[model samples]
Target: MIERILEQSKALIHVLSADRRTRHLVLTWQDTEVLESIHKTLHPLQEFTDALSGEEYVSISYLKPVLHLLKTKTLAEDPVDTDLTKSIKSRVIGYLQDKYNDPITQELLDIASFLDPRFKTNYIGKENIPAVKARMKAKMEEGTRKEKRSRVRDTEFNSLT
Candidate 1:
C-alpha cells in the first residue's frame, strides 16, 4: 500500500511541481530521496510476494529460504541505505523473525523445507539436520505401521468371508 502510494504520489508530485501554483506542494529534494529510499527498500518484497503468490508452484517450502534471503541479503543493511530505509528493513525483518521464532513453528517450516525435493534440508542448519531426519523417519515409520495394520485387518476379514 505504502509502496504504491509512493510510486503514484511521486509522479503526481512531479506533475504538480510543474505548475507555479502547486510547486510548494511538491516534496523537497530530501523528502524525494527518502521516498526513493523507501521504494528501493520495498521493491524486493513485492517481487517475492508476487512470486510466492503464484498458482503454478507450491509456496510453503519457500518460507524458510525466502525468509533467510530477506534477512541476510535482500533486506540487509547497506552502506548506502538511509536511516529510514534501515529502519524499515529492520522492522520488516524483525516482525517476520518474531512470527517464525516459535520452536514448533520453526520446526514445522524446517520440516516442510526438508520434505520438498527441491529444497530438502538446504535451509536447515547442520546441527538440526539429524534431528529433522529423525523426525521424518519417525513419521514414515508411523505411516508404514498403520498401513500394515490396515492390511492385516483386511486379510483377516477376507479369510472370514
Candidate 2:
C-alpha cells in the first residue's frame, strides 16, 4: 500500500518542473510548507537550482525513514485532522458546485457511486452493465481509430522527411 501511494506521489512529483532559480518545485509557498513537513520525515533532501552559482542542479534523494513516514499517510486510514479534512472536503465540494449540472460529471459520479463500498453493487451489475460496456467499447474503438490515424499520419510525415 505504501509503495502504491509512493508511486502515485512520485509520478505526480516527477511531472513537477523545478525552478532553475529556486531549485524548488514551483509549488505555492503554502504547499512548500506542507511539502517541507512531509519532507522532513526522511533524511534531508536538498534541492538545488541554477541560481545556486556553482551548483549544476538540485539533487534530492529519498531515504528510508521518509518513505516509511509517507507509507503511513494512506487515505484508507481516517485522516488525522478532522477539521483539516472537513475543511478540505468542503473546499473540493465547492469546486464541484458549478460542475454539478454536467452530464459527464454525473456519469463519473454514477460510476464512482458503484465503486464506493458503501453501496451495494447489484444495481450497477444488472442495470448499468450495458451502459458501462458501451462506454468501454466506445473508448476502445476510439483508441484503435486514433492509433490507425497516428500510424497513417506517421507514414505520411516520414515519407516527406
Candidate 3:
C-alpha cells in the first residue's frame, strides 16, 4: 500500500514535470526547493509506515514521535525563498495543528507514549508528565474494573448452571 501511494505520487510528479504549459509556469527554483523539502520530509515517514505495516498491532504511541519528526523536519528545511518557505511551512503547520491539537487525541497519544516501556515519559514534556501519568492510572483502573465485572458475571453464570 505504501509503495502504491509512493508510486502514484511519483507518477503525479512526473506528469507535472512533463507538462509543457504549466510546467514552465510552475517549476520555478523556489517551487523545486519546496518540492524537495516535502519529499525529504515524507521519505522517513514512508519508511516508518512501511515498518509499521509489518506489525500485527501498530500502537497510537507511534503518532507522537511521527508528529514530532514532521514538525522538526519541516522547520529544519532551509528557506530557499523566505516568502515561499514561510507560506509552505505555515500551511503544513496549520494542517497538522488543526488535525492533531484536540485535547482527547493528545491525551491518548500521551498515554500511549507513557505506557510504552521503551518510550515511557522520555518523549513527553515535563508539564504533561503528571497529566499523562494520571490518565494512565485511570485507564488501568477502568480495565481492572471491567475485568472484575466480567469475572463476576462468569462466576454467577457458573453458579446458576
TM-score per prediction, in order, is 0.85, 0.30, 0.61
What is candidate 2's TM-score against the reference?
A: 0.30
* Candidate 1 structure lDDT: 0.89
- lDDT at position 90, candidate 2: 45
**Ranking according to TM-score, highest score first:** 1, 3, 2
Give the best candidate by lDDT.
1
* True-vs-predicted CA distance for residue 116, candidate 1, Å: 1.4
RMSD of each: 2.6, 17.6, 6.1
TM-score of 3: 0.61
Segments in model 3 whose C-alpha atoms lie over 4 Å from true places? 1-56, 77-83
Off by over 4 Å in 2: 1-106, 110-125
Model 1 root mean square deviation, Cα atoms? 2.6
Model 2 Cα displacement at 26 (Å)?
49
* Model 3 per-residue lDDT tens digits across residues 53-112: 666785577778777777876444565635555566667667878998998888788888
lDDT of 1 by residue, 12-120 (tens): 7879989999888877778777878888888899989997898987898999999989999999999989899999999999999889999999899899999999899
Reference-based TM-score, model 1: 0.85
Error of 2 at 68 (Å): 32
> For model 1, what is the error of residue 41's alpha carbon versus the real structure, in angstroms, after optimal superposition?
0.8
